[model samples]
Target: MRNLIHVLFFALVVSFSFSCKEEPRTPPNILFIAVDDLRPELGCYGKSYVHSPNLDQLAAESSLFENHYVTVPTCGASRYNLITGQLPKNPGDLSNQASVSNIANKPAGERPTTFMQELKQNGYYTVGIGKISHHPDGYVYGYHEPKSDKIELPGSWDEMLLKAGKWGTGHNAFFGYADGTNRNGMAKEVKPYEAGEVGDDGYPDGLTAELAIEKLKSLKQQDKPFFLGVGFFKPHLPFTAPKGYWDLYDEENIPLAPFAEIPENSSKASLQNSGELNQYKLGEEKPHLDRVASDAYARKLRHGYLAAVSYIDAQIGKLLDELEEQELAENTIVVVWGDHGWHLGDQKTWGKHTVFDNALHSVLMIKRPGESGQRISQVVSTTDIYPTIMELTNVPSQATLDGESMVSLMENPAAKHWRNTAYSYFRRGISLRTPQYRLTKYFRDQPPAMELYNHQNDPYESKNVANEKPKVVKQLMPIWKKGNTGIFKE
Candidate 1:
């Protein structure tokens, strides 16, 4: 009898131990959020002006990347590089319809494999929402099907104009209905009735958030792992947000650009360039005004941008809250990234066209199950996201990705010698950003442009030390060339 009891207790102990020791499930669901044209100006990145409480909370719980950059500053180029995990060879004049139409119009299998396609192949239900593409067609980024049952939402201003029928002049001015007939009759600057209320009926970000919450609820009931890409279309242009968000910041309290005064010897290459003019389209409608002389107008523009950011942040918070409510937070990996950075009157440039820090640097935050809450200073690019996600989710990706995976850094935030420098490029300019410096070289056809900023000493990039630091420039120029050649191989 004694031996029988001892054997029974031993069997129970072994069974319990095995149950506890069974390998924890490694396949984690992925929640990927891509915000458009967002600069690293959040409270998490040490900016005090932007009210990003949810993002700040997320940073504290995630592995925050301090020196993350985009492959290109422009919309189409950056998106193409990010989705393909490769640098985009200058599409040049071939970007028009005549060139693209001749190529096959088939979906994922016919084209280069995207990160999304890889996920779908690995038995993950992949879904995309909102402005995932720079174009209106929205078939470019390898999404095989639309996730939502609703009719496709209008993504751009042109689409909105097509629906509303001559709504307002296509300019950055307060727009209201000329006749008080509908919700369009409401003042553009008027606050919404409530914080979460939706007016104007067709706000894309709010609609995207709504659709994502519905998807998340559905995924919760399913047994299979999933990949959800929720793309927000706000804070990009038109700067239209719920009026409550616009009311969040007082115009008087809005912070001015760190360097509002353009120095007398500022880069003529930057000044003569119509980068800002192209963005604002001043001469097309109204006479152009000097940015320096129109600080008030600039402030209004900044206010609108901040409002749009806050509105997007709120929508993101809603989706994240749904993930938590559905008990997916423990098993899901969330990555929030901006496709590229934007410019708000920086260097007299209004949009993302230059190789400046404001244009090139993007915000990347990765929150995994068991990662440390620390900021990583190593330089990384948006190109790295594809490989990192694949590795983390244990999905097999056959495509040759250009980026080196940072999976090691996720576990050990202080991994040494991971990467030395990160590279970003525009049409004819290339920028190499290291921990201590940034060096830019523009093609001679445009202007004899060179900018060198010693980040260790001058974080704001105030002084142009290119002429003074000839030896440094020579050393860094080769590094940039090597990076470009190594990545593109053309």
Candidate 2:
């Protein structure tokens, strides 16, 4: 009887100890979707005519940022700020080759090249598909050059995959047309828009989405967490989509840019001749700072852009569906972000490069594990994404970041004492976007280098009120100088 009692007691003790042992908590997975040149012109942003149902639905279920702005107005520089969590320190930091010059082939120092690299160091499986970095395929290659073995952000991604299909290379597929022709091979002879009669797979973004879904299936089998960054290339340039997306809108019903004319009392340095649009040599009409494109042509281009947005929206829907099907939605953090905004004949410009609101404002939505969807109207910067991701995953950072963690804002978007400020740098100017005003200071030898627009009175930014509002300029100058990190001097 004594032996029996001792045996049972020992067994009970072992059972209790086993039950009390803490199982290692699985880290939350991250699904980061980056869309190129996607402005705040979607249905969620109150553009009823734009067919972006997928993104709108996602916004309804996620924390939608109403005043999210990029650190820079261009693709590469903006993405650089996003990935590095740093301000522009040199001229290269403001250009398309920012990634290649600063990050590629560099040995890991005290600071990792990107937040993705930091995640990898912390035992997360990082995978990048398509244009997560400056290069279309995340490789160091020119638009016309053959694919190279050189990785763009080495050590950051465990796998950087690109399915070029009939286009031969990623860069070619980026600007590819329906017939497998690209602008690089044809010397920019292609038109600015194409409505192909084929299906979604006819374009590279469709291939990207399919590849991401397949990857998710594989990731589900892994015993660790993943940080998958899937980038969609659309609505960027040569606005091309399947005929089905183009059919979603009526050409005549598409509205033209309301503020298509240049602002009153603004310097010519503040505007460009739509040079990026004219690069499409076969484009029907050329728009200049003084010469606005005809309304008919403007509507057509806007129609093409909306179609591209709808097409990308479908790809995003596919990704979200796969996440739910894999049961990853419950444990994963999903973020849909736009690299930068585009100007569809806004201020008579057809591209993004200036420091205007059209070029700075972009889409930002974050769906965390337990958070309910809400709209955050406070101004936030692209650099804030880095620290936010790190904090969410509980990954420690080795280097100091420029932007503050938005975790507090994410938890309580209506949290008081929130910083409602965002800064955008471009065209030799640093533009500061406060809640009710936009003040831009340009570094130039010319006069009237400052431009201010009060959103409280003139939301359209129709006039430069720097001379009219001296007190406002004085109040904003100190904040504006914070973002002028000597890149202009470089």
User: lDDT value for candidate 1?
Assistant: 0.66
Residues 1-490 of candidate 2 have per-residue lDDT tens digits of 9999999999999999999999977899999999999999899998998889899999998999999999888888899899999988877788988887778856556334589988999999999999998898999988878999999888799999998899999999999998899989999988999999989999999999999999999999988799999999998888999999999999999988878878888876887788888999999999888788998999989999999999999999999999999999999999999999888888878899988899999999999887788999999989899999999999999756889888899788888877788988888888999989999988887657899998888877889999989999999999888888888862
Span of 10 residues, lowest total lDDT, candidate 2: 104-113
Per-candidate Cα RMSD to the true structure, in Å, reads 6.7, 2.4
Off-target runs (Cα >4 Å) in candidate 2 are 1-23, 110-112
Q: Which candidate leads the pack in TM-score? A: 2
lDDT of each: 0.66, 0.90
State, as a TM-score between 0 and 1, how close model 2 is to the true structure: 0.95
Q: Using Cα atoms with residue i matched to residue i, what is each candidate's TM-score against the true structure?
A: 0.80, 0.95
lDDT tens per residue, model 1, 1-490: 9999999999999999998896967489988888887988788998888888888888888989989998778665676666668765554311322113222243324455668767777777766665444432233322222222221212211111111222322111112122222122332233211222344333556656787888899888776788887777657765667677877788888876675433333354543243333334322222121534266666677787888788888888888899999999999999899878876766655667767788888889999976657788888888788899888988888887878788887777677857757778764567788989988776645444677888897776667788888999988887777655432222
Clashes of each: 0, 0
